[model samples]
Target: MLPGPRRLKRPSDFGATVRRGSRAATPTVVVHVRRTIDQDPPDFTRVGFVVSKKVGNAVTRNRVKRRLRHFAGDLDAQFNTDVVVRALPAAALEPQRVRDDLEDAWARAFARAAAC
Candidate 1:
């Protein structure tokens, strides 16, 4: 058998961690983040992606999700807390552009979390 793509499970978990968390906005992305002070196993911090039909067909949406996942992994070290990243329509833009936007949004989200 093959392993499925590693990803966060449970909407409730994402909600609880970043419900009232801070938000960072960029031209192409918006990131919502919250600190998770409680965890039983503390296995790994998680992230979620939300892309809507407005972005495009299945392929475009999946591409955006993949990009977001890669971007999230690159920023894993910075995210000491749990985060939920919601994709905006602009995410369908060029790959490098999307990456830049996400990086900016993440920086802002991290800054906000630190202030709290």
Candidate 2:
């Protein structure tokens, strides 16, 4: 699990990440990268998950959230950014694919964030 401070818990934070953040995506998942103004730890990067109802029922959505929360450890970036990983409907069929897609998404997200 992400440490409490490293998690993006509020709705507004998620909204900002999606709205103003740089984005990178595959067919299965999208990674949003937003620079944060919060004055907490400098290198800490916050993360949130958005597994919409289109992905599955509650049980399945929770499962995907858990999986995403686990693998997203590797996504600990050096900047003070808010990162959101949004799942697409096709992710219901395969969980491992999400990790792979997240890896690709993270690379693209960093590139895009740099440009921003």
Q: Choose the strongest candidate by lDDT.
A: 2
lDDT for each residue of candidate 2 in 1-116, tens digit (9 for 90 to 100): 79888888999999998999999989789999988776664477889999999999999999988888988986657567889999898777877688889889987897788777
Q: Give the TM-score of candidate 2.
A: 0.91
Candidate 1 per-residue lDDT, tens place, 80-107, comes to 5667788888788656788888888888
Q: Which stretches of candidate 2 lie above 4 Å from their native place?
A: 38-42
Could you list the CA RMSD of all candidates, in the order they appear? 3.2, 1.6
C-alpha TM-scores of all predictions: 0.82, 0.91
